[model samples]
Target: MERAISASDANQRFSELLREVAEGESFTVMSRGRAVARVLPVDRAREQRSIQHLLKFVAALPVRHAGNWSRDELYE
Candidate 1:
């Protein structure tokens, strides 16, 4: 379950909140008593894998000579 914290409480207890999130706990920051933002641990492995996949996709594309064509030409 996500922990909820009021805006004022979050501001006052920022450090503690961060500690909880760093430990893989999720939080919902409330503004005007309504949930507005979320804090959670970074999924570094997943993020890195996604970045690597994107880079591979980009690298695999054929390089165009100067003034060759627009991106649409490559996909179409």
Candidate 2:
């Protein structure tokens, strides 16, 4: 569960908040007693793997052909 913190408090302790987040603590920033934003640490390994998968998928796509028919042509 994320800890809730008021906006003013978050602003006042931004550096400390970042340190906590880096240590695996997530937070929900509130404005007017309402949740406004979330602060969480990124999973670098997962993020890097996701980017690698995307790059590989894009690289494997077939190149376009000059005589290729559009989807409309297939429907017709």
Candidate 3:
């Protein structure tokens, strides 16, 4: 779960929060005891999404039969 940060604290330490978020730490900014916004690592999110999409694409690909080869060639 992402950690919660009150609006005031977020405002007071915006620079530090941004640095931490950029380093892959996520946070939910709260207001009046409720979540109002979120902070996340953009690069990490994009990389994770790209990797997941690539994995799904690879998984859906059809497997090809292996060609017959001599025992020595197979071992090599």
lDDT of 1 by residue, 19-53 (tens): 98888898899998788999889999999999999
- Which ranking of candidates, highest lDDT first? 2, 3, 1
Q: Write the per-residue lDDT of candidate 2 for residues 1-76, one digit (tens) a residue.
A: 6899999999999999999999999999999989999999999999999999999999999998779789999899
Any runs in candidate 3 off by more than 4 Å, and if so which?
44-76
Q: Quantify all predictions' global Cα lDDT against the true fold.
A: 0.91, 0.96, 0.93
After superposition on all C-alphas, the RMSD of every candidate to the true structure, in Å, is: 6.8, 7.3, 11.7
Kindly report which residue pairs in candidate 3 clash with one another. none
Clashing pairs in 1: none
TM-scores of all models?
0.70, 0.69, 0.55
Q: Can you tell me which runs of candidate 1 are displaced by over 4 Å? A: 62-76
Task: Supply candidate 2's per-residue lDDT for 41.
Answer: 97
Candidate 1: minimum summed lDDT over ten consecutive residues — where? 62-71
Show pairs that collide, candidate 2: none
- How many clashing residue pairs are found in candidate 3? 0
Off by over 4 Å in 2: 61-76
